[model samples]
Target: MYVTFVGHVIEWRGPAPFYFVRVPEDECAGIQEVASAATYGWGVIPVSARIGEIDFSTSLFPKDGGYLLPIKNAVRKPQNLSAGDEVTVEMTVRL
Candidate 1:
């Protein structure tokens, strides 16, 4: 399943801060339908995603009944993405 949407980058402070793009509620509904087929385990969904021409593979984390798309540094640096930035994501769920 493939999906595209715009989301705001958010920062989560842990031992180290992390960045993510929270998937919108509307998009979550569609992803839920295919969640079972795509999730490897722990309700986390595997996906190939692109941001500003940088492509990477990561797992969507379940949060607040929705999903958080982790934006890794490898993909962030080149794109100059950071917290509070609005970004367009092209993602594909591998079933």
Candidate 2:
């Protein structure tokens, strides 16, 4: 099954490098696991993942405060993404 989400590229900071797309405040519940962590050795850790295709709209903010990009359903190899390129990601949710 495939789902669709609309958000903006917020940032990219992961062990394997993932996009941080921000969903709107009202639609935030549609996505889950939106949390942050502060590790003493690893520094700040942002937790975000979701199911289905994530479509980043053209309207994006210049600041790095958008919703977290959903990497859970990434279809293509996650390493192929960049910092600022808006994309429509397709993926399968792992069970």
Candidate 3:
């Protein structure tokens, strides 16, 4: 399954700090339907994600009641993205 949306990158200061983009509530709802088949465990949904012209693979983390799309440093560097930046994201769920 494929989905696209714009989200703001935010810094998450967990045990280890990282960047993430929240999947919109509407998209999250749709993802939830297919999440069981796509998620391996711990509500981690495997997906191929693209930001700008860069593409990478990562797992969507379920937080609160929504999913957070991790924006890795490799993807951030080339795209010149940082926390608080609004970015267009395209994701293909690996089911």
Candidate 4:
């Protein structure tokens, strides 16, 4: 399924910094409908996404009843994105 949303970038300070864009609440419902079929394991859903001029594949990490789309450094740097920056994402849930 294809979906598009705009959200702010957030950082999780692990051993290394991890960045993500939270899927909007309104979008969660449709994702939940296909979650069971789409999640490979541990509630992680695989998706392909486009941000700015780049397209890449990544998995959505389930969190707090929603999903967080990881923004890899490869994609982020090219687009000049940083934490708290608003980004528009077009994604496809791979079912």
Give the candidate number with the greatest TM-score: 4
Instruction: Write one digit per residue (lDDT tens) for candidate 4, span 1-95.
Output: 99999999999999999999999999889999999999999999999999999999999999999999999999999888999999999999999
RMSD of candidates 1 onward, in order:
0.7, 9.3, 1.0, 0.6
Q: Write candidate 2's Cα lDDT for 32-53 as tens digits.
A: 2322222122222233233233
Runs of candidate 1 exceeding 4 Å displacement: none
Which runs in model 2 stand beyond 4 Å of their true positions?
1-3, 14-16, 29-67, 72-79, 89-95
State which candidate, 3 or 4, has the greater lDDT: 4
User: What RMSD value applies to candidate 3?
Assistant: 1.0
Q: At residue 15, what lDDT does model 4 achieve? A: 100
| lDDT tens digits by residue: candidate 1, 3-79 | 89999999999999899999999889999999999988999999999998888999999999999999999988788
- Compared with the true structure, all predictions reach lDDT values of 0.93, 0.37, 0.94, 0.96
Reference-based TM-score of each model: 0.96, 0.32, 0.95, 0.98
The digit string of per-residue lDDT tens for model 3 on 1-95 reads 89999999999898987999999999999899999999999999999999999999999999988999999999998888888999999999899
lDDT of model 4 at position 71: 98
Worst 10 residues of 2 by lDDT: 34-43
Clashes of each: 0, 5, 0, 0
Clashing pairs in 2: 20-69, 21-67, 21-69, 22-66, 22-67
